[model samples]
Target: MNLQSILSQHIIKAVSESYAATLENIEFQATRKDFEGDITVVVFSMLRTVKGNPVQIGETIGEYLVANVAEVSKYNVVKGFLNLVLSDAYYLDFFTSIQNFNSYGKVPATTEAIMVEYASPNTNKPLHLGHVRNVLLGYSVAEILKAAGKKVYKTQIINDRGIHICKSMLAWKRYGNEETPQTSGLKGDKLVGNYYVKFDKEYKKEINTLVENGFTEKDAKAKAPILLEAQKMLQKWEAGDPDVVALWKKMNGWVYEGFDATYENIGVDFDKNYYESDTYLLGKDFIQSGLEKGVFEKDADGSVWCDLTDEGLDRKIVLRSDGTAVYMTQDIGTAIQRVKDFPDINGMIYTVGNEQDYHFKVLFLILKKLGFSWAENLYHLSYGMVDLPSGKMKSREGTVVDADDLISDMAATAKEISEELGKIDDFSAEEKTQLYKTIGLGALKYYILKVDPKKRILFNPEESVDFQGNTGPFIQYTYARIQSILRKAASASGYTESVEIRNLTLEPKEKELLKILQQFPDVIQLAAGNYSPALVANYTYDLVKEFNSFYQNVPIFGAENPAEISFRISLCDAVGSVINTAFSLLGIQVPDKM
Candidate 1:
């Protein structure tokens, strides 16, 4: 068991014997820096049961703990705070026990599974800066959950069929003389996205022309020839028109190829993908079931809706009056279908923007009202919008920050800054190029993932790529420095992976580093519980800071004895291993020689 668990157990025993108090919960916090202790037990919380002077109660408990616990060498009481000073042998024993730091914090997988859905992008446009946040958050949370011993399935639902999709298709057909992604020398998604923008431009012009000719703006918008044709195309596609279906297949195929490239570049992958074309019609049957069960109400016009008035939400439409499924219907069907596909999956997390927060709330409630056992496990990982330093992005007007372009720009920025700093002097051309991308993408992912998901981000690419402070490059550089130290130590001693030194003394900085390392498993569990990657990201930064302090104040290679040098080298290896593992969880890469 961990030291904290051991301490808690002994402390409870002491309270029961000395104070005769049957306490169920014990609150522990970091020892105040002003106090000479490692962990502080809050004596204030025990006053209800023990009914005595808090200081005296603390002193009695501390005396009992120091007398009984091997790790607890001594203790002190500051008011109601019972501060316990643990022995150095305890830390050394703990460090020696964790032999494989690479997988130290991870737990064995359980039978129950979780499904995390992220990066559900539309085929109409390429991914943007906003999609970056969604994917990073989802991917990191999935990793955190897996580390916490839960089986996880990563997935996405592609928005490949809709009126917006038809707009792009119609535009490509009207404007192009048989141009393809290969012919245009552009990615399929980007080529299709250009047409989507083109359709909006032409549609606006048509609307203005009709309005000038004495039509209302609404009428003009509805009556625009291009939009009407796009609507007709959607109807035809829905009706399984042969030519329209073929065009859609061909265009969507291009988009899938393009999207695959982007997802690969972003270092995220899905185990399965659900398509709108296949799943859009799924929830109709569920709607009928809900209506039969009185979970939903059927209006006089034949529309199906769930009345959420008592739940503080307005009525939500599941099916239209024309017997067509809405997004809500499709979502409900898709969720049920997933359960059918993966019987072991007990929960699902939908990584989506905060704009649809109400949508998810209503969806989850309706599912619960319909009496699905797993409905209670549904969570919407709602995140705020991402804005660039320049301004907000609009995809239709082509002012959006394309994911591919942003990634490339970040790499180029890394190259510029690295060359200016002269940090890659000993690297070959190929190594330099790879390191640049690693550092660049690392910076981007870290800058975004470190912030709380609900907070709006004003992304500054330049600021993010800096090789100092709490950035990804900073942590990566520390890992590289450790790597360099390990290489030198290995060469000097022909070092093996053994830490046999049992009697070596540790400095204050070394003990501080060990203390932070001890918190890794707890941090992983906490991050998973909160479904927050920010917690993991910031924890990693703190670990790096602690390691840096140790590196600065202690001597690793030039230790007083061979045992001390070996122990310090072992500590360095463990820190590097953890840094690599943590970065891997965030989907960021750390270079060995950055």
Candidate 2:
């Protein structure tokens, strides 16, 4: 139903051949302004097996293709490439096609279920800039998949227990810290994080003093019993010791409350939340089950491990030698539990840092060993970390970018920009804040998503995100401008489609512009196929740049011919829809005014 399918079908049918799905790629090329085409098809790629001169083969195929195709007005074989030019008369039909289906270029009957797990954060602290990357990549992946007719399941896992959480609890308890979040005038996560840092400082000093004596640093650190006491606290809560459970529940509630605000602000959500605390025991059971099934082996001292050395991976510990759960154990248990919860699930995906590539590789291998047929469906959407200009962010050195503080800072900057532009003169105070939230969050999400997810990116606050040129705000403003023009055009009196565009006879600028505009569908399919939202990001900017050029060179409303005006308006509508949809897939909201 989309442009590619229609065009591909025409090509295959003319060849007297059939495929389950046709393979066709449409792209823009630069071959000097004198070149007579917009989109170039590499006919050589298809004809290489035939063993002939690519130029003649392209010419023959291009002629045959034009004979079968009605949408394309003409074809030119240039330097062994067959470039097809779409007829201006068929432009309205294509626009009408997209408008009618409401799917735009999304292929029908190509339903795939995708699980996107993003924005997974630890409860010990609020989210940081690192989490923003995870959230953006995960959200964008889900949106891209959904746009391609896939049912996407978004989920998150909270690393809410273990030594990390214990550090905060210990600090809060020992520092005369009966102070609650509200009482201390601090956000929930920040209040808890203060104690986490404090514990590290205090614990390190205690270990240093012990080391200054006869004890080794390692021995002294282990002998201090702080982490042991933290473990005891965890055990007490698990045992339903009333006071310990009360504190644990209260503190975690505040953290969740803070996390909810952050998620809501950033337009990120998950269908399910998996807590390490709840699932660690499930992992233990899963490991024991794997052991009984002859998929795993027992270590000395009653520990459990999975040996993947045969697969060029090191052995992984599941449960500690003391039989307590490790992070890996909890992950294994959660995967199984998720499958059990949703037996109809076609797949599971983990959105985690690239640093954990080895961890997930081992996890999936163990799952496959346990005979889970869906192991092949498991995916690790590993994204690189966001580092600062100085280098990698480290918490102990206090270089970590706290999530709430950073968002607040960005929102304030957005507010300043909005005020400078007088963009919210008509809005209420609360509405103004909402606008700031939208702008700030959209800026952050788009900034993160525009880069290839696999590559490490420096989130330079100054240069990386600018108000003008290829930023989220630029696209939003373009959408708003088109909307304004359309509103004015619609309200204008006595307008009619009075002229015909039999020969496109376009200016060089218009041809260059149309070339990019026509590739929207192809871009969507590529983004979906690759599981990469950067494709969408790149496509949106390309379209915007084309539209900008078109806007400057061509007059829509004041054109001499009414038909030309109407045609231009229709073109604007199509371009606007594609821009909006593409940005939506990148988890960016377009504002009507900004």
Candidate 3:
């Protein structure tokens, strides 16, 4: 058991023996910074059961703990808080017992399985800054879940079929003379995205011309010839027109290649990919069943709707009057298909933007109403949009910051700052390039993951890559520093394994570092439970801060004794291992030589 569990058991015994009163539970908090204690027990909570002055009660518990608990070296009663200082031997014993620091806080895989769907990008455009956040959040959460012992399958649904796609195809056909990714030297997605913008521009011009001719703006927008043609293209594609299908497949192939390069650049991958084209028709049969069972109602227009009004949500359409499936139907079908694909997956996490928060709520409720036991385990990892300092992005106007561009800019920024620092003089050109990529992507991932997923971020590349404060480069530099120390220690003593630390009084700084290191496993579990990488990110920052304080205040290689030096070096090794493990969970890489 951990320190807290041991202390709680002893505290319960102390309270029972001292006051002859049984306690049901104990409340604890981190010791205040000004207080000389490792953990604080709240004495005021006992007042609800055993009536007495709070101070007297606190003193009684503190005295009882010091007398009864072996780890409790001393205690002080500060008001109703009983601050208990743990013995240095306790921390030293805990540190010495840890044999493998590399895999220290990770858990073995459990039977329970979860599917995390992220980076569900549309095939029409290259990934943008918004997708950057989604992929990073989703990937990190999946890693965190794995660390917490769940069998996780990473996947995404490719949004390959829709009217938006038809717009791009039509734009390409009307404007281009058989241009392709190879001939244009543009990524398939970017080329298609350019056409999408072109279609919007032309469609708007048509709308304006019709309005000038006395047509209502709404009617003009709907009646625009380009819009009508795009709709017809969609219909033809749906009807399996061979030529239309061929064009759709060709364009989607290019987009998929573009998306693959982007995902690879960002260091995120998936175990499976679902296509909208295949899944869109999946829920029609389910909708019929829901209608027959009165779980859904058919409107007068012969459209199918799920009446969620009793559940406090508005009615959601499942199928159009023309018998075409809606997005909702497609999603329901996708969920069922996934369960069929992975029978062991008991839960799913949809890592999407917060705008579809209600959509997920209704989806989950409908699944539960459909009598799926796993629906209760479904979660929507809703997150806010990422805004640059410039402002919001509009995808259609080509104003969104492309994911590929942002990643490239981050590397360039890292290269500039690292070159200015002049810290890698011994590195070759290729090594330098690799290190720059590591630092750049690490900064990007860390900066985004460090924030709570629900909060919008105003990302600044310069700030994230800085080597000071709560940034990725700062933590990475510290890890490099520890590696340097280890290399020296190995050269000096010819020993790299952990040494047994016995009968030595650890310095305050050493004990503090060990205390923080011990909390890593708990932090991972907490992060996984909340599906928040921010918790893991911030915890790592705190650990780094603690290690820095220890490094500055204590001596390792220059220590007077061999045992002390070995113990300190071991501590440094442990810290570096943790830094690497934590960064891995965030999908960030750490460099050995910085």
Quote each prediction's TM-score: 0.96, 0.88, 0.97
- For candidate 1, write residues 411-470 as lDDT tens digits: 988888889989779999999999888988998899889999899988775554555798
> Tens digit of lDDT per residue, candidate 2, span 1-594?
755567666665544443232334433344444656545667666653445676776676677767787766788887767777766556544443454323565655345665667866778887788988888888888877777777877888887776677778878999935999878887787778788888888888878888888799789989766767877887776777898767777888889988888887777788888887778688777777899997788976888888888999888888888888887887778888888877766777777899999989998998899888888888888888888998898775578887777777767878899999996699889888877877776777777788988999887755646667877777877888888877887798645434355444555555555556656667877987777889899888888987888898788887766666776776777677777788888888877666
Residue range with the least summed lDDT across 10 consecutive positions in model 1:
459-468
For each candidate in the order shown, give its overall lDDT on alpha carbons: 0.90, 0.75, 0.89
Stretches of model 2 off by over 4 angstroms after superposition: 1-34, 41-75, 101-103, 106-112, 299-301, 422-431, 462-464, 495-518
Model with the higher TM-score, candidate 1 or 2: 1
Model 2 lDDT, residue 129, Cα: 88
> How much is the lDDT of residue 415 in candidate 1?
88
Segments in model 3 whose C-alpha atoms lie over 4 Å from true places: 460-467, 494-498
Q: What would the per-residue lDDT of candidate 3 be over residues 328-362, giving only the tens digit for each residue?
A: 88888889889999999998999999999998999
lDDT of 3 at 587: 95
Q: How many residue pairs clash in each candidate?
A: 0, 0, 0
Better of 1 and 2 by lDDT: 1
Model 1 Cα displacement at 145 (Å)?
1.4
